[model samples]
Target: MELTYLRTFREVAKWGSFTKAAETLGYAQSSITTQIQKLEEAYGAVLLERYGRKMVLTMAGEALLQYANYICRLHDESKEVVAKQSKGTLSIGTIETLASFYLPAYLQAYRKAYPDVNVAIQPGNEPFIIDAVKEGALDIGIILDPPFSDPELDCSILREEPLVIIVSPDHPLAGQGEIGVEDLENESLILTEDGCTYRAMLLKVLKSNQVTFKLSYEFGSLEAIKQCVTYGLGIALLPRIAVTEEVMAGKLAAIPFIHPECKFYTQLICAKKKWKSKAYVGFLELLSGGAREGDSDAGSELSK
Candidate 1:
C-alpha cells in the first residue's frame, strides 16, 4: 500500500471526520474520500463506516491504524537516517500566551539553524496540545501550566512562569505591596477563555476563598484582556511574561499577587517514542537548553 494513503487513513481516523482530516492535511474533501477508498480497496475491507455525523473506523480499520502508525513513523525515520538531511517539517502545538510572548526568539534561532526545515505552529489549549503530541500529530507541545506528566511523554519544566494580576496603573490596588484573594472581593475581573490554566486557577482561588467577584469581560485573546485591563475595565490574571513590556511602560501595573496554588510553569512535552529528526532535536535543544548547538546567545535572554 502507498504511504500517503496510510497517512490519509490515519488522519481520517484521528479526527473521525473526513472534512476535518481534509482540512488538516490540506486536501480537498473529495481527495480525502478518494484516498480512503483506495486504502480500503488495497486492504480489501470496509475500513470506515458512517455513524450519525462521524466517520468511525471498522474492526479492520482499527487493526490497520495500529500498523499505519508504526509504518508511517518508521518510514519518516528511515528517510532521515538514510538521507541524513536537515530538511523536513516540524509541527509544534502551543498555547497563545507562549506563542505570542515566549517562543519567538527560540523559533527564530531554530529557523536560522535549519533554514530548510519547515515549521508549523498550531495554537491550542494545553489539553488539545497534549493530545496532539500524544497522537503524533504534533512533534512538540508547549504550555503554561502546573507541573505535568504523562507516562507516554517526555515532560520537562522549561521555566517557572509567574502569574500576576494586572490592572491599570491608577487602579486602587495597583500600588499595593501585596494582594491576595480577599483583596479582589466584589471587584470586576477580566478573564481569558475557559480552557486557560491560569484562568482556571484564578477561578478556583476565588471560589475556594468565597470571594464574590464579577466577571466584567471574558476574552479569548490575550491582547484583548490586556487592553481591557489597561482601560481599567477590570483586573486580569495573566502570565508576567505576557505583560512585561506593558508593565515596564507604565501602561499596566502588576500587583504583588502570589498564591502557591496559582503557580504555573512553561513546560515542554513530546512523545517518548517520537523520532528525533535533525530539526526536531535542534528545536528541542533550543527549548530545553535555551540555545541551539553552537549558538551561544540565541534565546539566552529567555533563560534569564
Candidate 2:
C-alpha cells in the first residue's frame, strides 16, 4: 500500500531484473529483493518470478504495475501543477550522441527562456535514459530510437537525424558517391559502444544485406571514434551533424547510405500523463517551434 513499495515494484517490473533496478535506483541488490518481498507480503500475493536469467511479473505483479503507473503519474502530475518558477529543477537524460551533436542549441534556448530555472542532464544510453524517465529521475530524455507506443512515455519527433558513413578522405570508401549497404562488407568498422541505438541500427541493416558486420574498435566516446576515423583508422556510420565539421575540413568524408533503412531519428521523450510545468512546457514549445533540427544534413535521405 505504501507509495515507496509501489514505486520500487514498478522499477523492478519495468526492468525485469532486480539487479538492474537496484543499480538504477541507487539501492543495494538485497534492498531491491527485500522491497519486492515486502510488497508481495503487503499484497498477499506473488509479484514476480524468475524466468531463466531474467525475472518476470506474475499476474499479481502485472495487476500491481498498472495501478503503480497510474498512481505515480497522478503523483507527479499533482507536484508539477503546483510547481512555480521559483521551485524545482528540470532534470534531463540523454544519449551522448545527441548530447554532443544536437542538444546544445535547445539547451541554450531553454536557458534563455527560463532564466530563473535550473536544468540538469545525465548522459546515458537509450535504455538508461528511458528507465530514468520512467522512474521519475528525469523530466525529459532526448534519444535516437525509432518511435513506438508506450503507456508510460510520450515521444515528440524533433528531427530526422540522418546518418552518414564517415572515413578519412583518402580511405577507399571516401567520395564513392553514395555507397550501397553491400559496400560495407569486409570493411573495418569503428563504432560507438555495443549498446548504442545507432550502432544497433547500422548492424541490423548490414546483417539484412548479408554484409559481414565486424567491429574494428569500439569507443565509449563519439569524439574518440571521430578522431580515429579522421586518421583513417576505420569507417563509421554516424549522425551527419557529428561529423560535419570534420567532413567540411576535408579531414573526413560523409558518404551517404543508399539503403532506405539506414536512417535514424531524434525524439523528445517524457513521462506520459504527467503535468508539464511552465519551464517544461516552454522547453517543449521551443522544440515544437523547430529549433531541435538546426543541423542541416550534409547528405542523406530523411523523410518525416
**Clashing residue pairs found in predicted model 1:** none
Candidate 2 per-residue lDDT over residues 56-133, each given as its tens digit: 998988888898999999988877656645346888888887787666766776676677678887999999989899
How high is the CA lDDT of each candidate model?
0.87, 0.81
Residue 50 accuracy (lDDT) in model 1: 98
Please provide the root mean square deviation of candidate 1 (C-alpha atoms, Å): 17.6
Q: What alpha-carbon RMSD in Å does predicted model 2 have with respect to the real structure? A: 20.2
Per-residue error at 70 for model 1, in Å? 32
Best by TM-score: 1
Position 110, candidate 1: lDDT: 74
Best by lDDT: 1
- Per-model TM-score, in order, reads 0.70, 0.67
